[model samples]
Structures are given as structure tokens and as C-alpha cells.
Target: MKKAYRIKKDKEFQLVFQKGASFANRQLVIYYLEKKDQQHFRVGLSVSKKIGNAVTRNQVKRYIRQAFIDLENRIKDNYDIIIIARNPVKDMDYHEIKKSMQHLFYKTELYK
Candidate 1:
């Protein structure tokens, strides 16, 4: 299943990037911010052109989306999350990508 888009506010994105906090696990960089509702976790993916051409960027987004889809319901609420693709992602395999994202999210306190 595809995960729904829940992050639509620039303010929320800013908070996650500027104030929320971040963690990296060799597979993904996660930025997350807490909220009041505890049940409203939203996620976004960012794979810039700097990462690659359209194909690579879309591939990165797809991987992030698929991973998040499996874990979204289990994540903590009232938070917005952004996944930043790194150079490390360019060469990693699919499972490695998923594991990295999972590990990073847990490290960022979004999974618990």
C-alpha cells in the first residue's frame, strides 16, 4: 500500500528541518518534529536533482514511500517527517535502504 501524504504545511516542514531534530543510519536521513495530536504523523520524501536525473530521484522517492507505507501506522503521532536521500543511497540495495530508514526512524524516536 502507498502511504498517504499528510505533510502539507511549510511551517511543519520548517520545524522538522530547523527545530524538530534529525538522525541518520547509513541508509536514510530523517527529520522529524513532534506535535500535539499524537495521531497525525505525516511523511515526505526529498530526492533532489543533485542526487541524480529524474529516474534516480523517482527511485529514491519510491523506496522511501514503500518503506514508510509499511511503518506509518506504527509511528508516533503529531509529527512531520522528511526523508533526505544521501550519497550512500545511490549504491545501496533495496533491503539495505529499508533497514536504514527503519533504523534511522527508530533512532529519531519516531518509531517509539
Candidate 2:
């Protein structure tokens, strides 16, 4: 994802966590806050060290970013969305990760 579309700051992540509505499945947790002033959606990804080593964490993040890129057009354009990967994600491949994320998005009505 582009720099403009990513949430990279600690403060921003905290705001979303404190104020956003959340939805989850076994593999992922999503927290989304509506941002009416923004022209498009922004995403933050979190993969804890507990999930794996650096390479594994980065791979999980890459997969999540790819899923968002593929679903860009279908996702709502006015929210700041944060995705937190759970332990089960370490065992999942790209497609499984994408499916789990899609489930959470649909549950939260973020998918259009």
C-alpha cells in the first residue's frame, strides 16, 4: 500500500483502538473507525512478535497488504481500519488469510 493509505503512527492506532468498532474471526481482528473527512480508507496492520520471528511477521503483513490491495475497490472508502493478526494466522496461507479478513469486513459491513 502507498504511504498515504497506511496508518503508521502509534497515536493513530491507539485512537482507532479506543474509538472504533471491532469485528473478528479466529485468524484476524478488525477495528474500524469512520472518518467522514477522508476521501479514502487507510489501513494499519499489527502482527505481534509472539506470532513468529521477524520474517514470519513481515510475511503475514505482506499478505494482509496484498489482500487489501486486491479488495481496494470493494472496501468502503471512509474508514480507518486496523487489522490484528492472531496466532492461527501463522498456520494460514495467503488465501486463508484473505478469506478470514473478508469475513471480518463483511461482519463489520466494511465491504461494499
Candidate 3:
């Protein structure tokens, strides 16, 4: 993901966690908060150490990012979003991860 669309600060993630509404499935949790004045979406991704070692966690993060890249333009805008990966996600393939992400996002009703 590009810098402009990434939520990189701890404070921003906290704000989303505290104020946003969330949706989830077996492998992913998604949180989102509207930003009326902003013109685009910002997203954050997290994969905990419990999921795996550094290599596995990073791979999960990459898959999540790829899913986001495919859906970003189709989703509703002006929000700070966070995606959290669960331990069970370590066994999933790219297509499964993508499907899981799409399903969770659909529950949020934040897509166009």
C-alpha cells in the first residue's frame, strides 16, 4: 500500500479501535471509522506474533495488503480502517485470505 493510504501511527490505530465499528470472521477483524472531511481511505494491518514467527506474520500482512489493494477502489471512502489477523489465518492461502477479507468487509456494509 502507498503511504497516503496507510495508517502508520499508534494514535491513529487507537482512535479507530476506540471509536470505530468493527466486523470479523474466523481469520480477520476489521475496524472502521468515518472521516467526513477526508477524501480517501486509510488502512492499517496487524498480524500478531501468536500467529507465527516474523516470517509468517509478515506473509500474512502481505496477503492482507494484497486483498486491500484489490478492494480499495471499490470500497467506500473517507475512513480509517484496521485489519487484524487471527492465529488461525496462518494456515490460509491467498485466495482464502482474500475471501475472508471480503466477507468481513461486507459485514461492515462499507463497500460501494
Please give the lDDT score for candidate 3.
Answer: 0.90
TM-score of each: 0.83, 0.98, 0.96
Number of the candidate with higher TM-score, 1 or 3: 3
Model 2: per-residue Cα lDDT over 7-32, one tens digit each? 99999999999999998888999999
Q: Please provide the root mean square deviation of candidate 2 (C-alpha atoms, Å).
A: 0.6
The deviation in Å at residue 47 for candidate 2 is: 0.3
lDDT of 1 by residue, 7-99 (tens): 657776777799878887655778887768555677877776787888887877777778777887778767778888987787776677888
Which tens-of-lDDT digit does each residue in 6-111 have in candidate 3?
A: 9999999999999999988888889999999988999899888899999999999899889889998878898889999998899999999999988887788878
Candidate 3 clash pair list: none
What is the lDDT of every predicted structure here? Answer: 0.75, 0.94, 0.90
What's the lDDT of the predicted structure labeled candidate 1? 0.75
Best-to-worst ranking by lDDT: 2, 3, 1
Residue 48 shift from truth in candidate 2, angstroms: 0.3
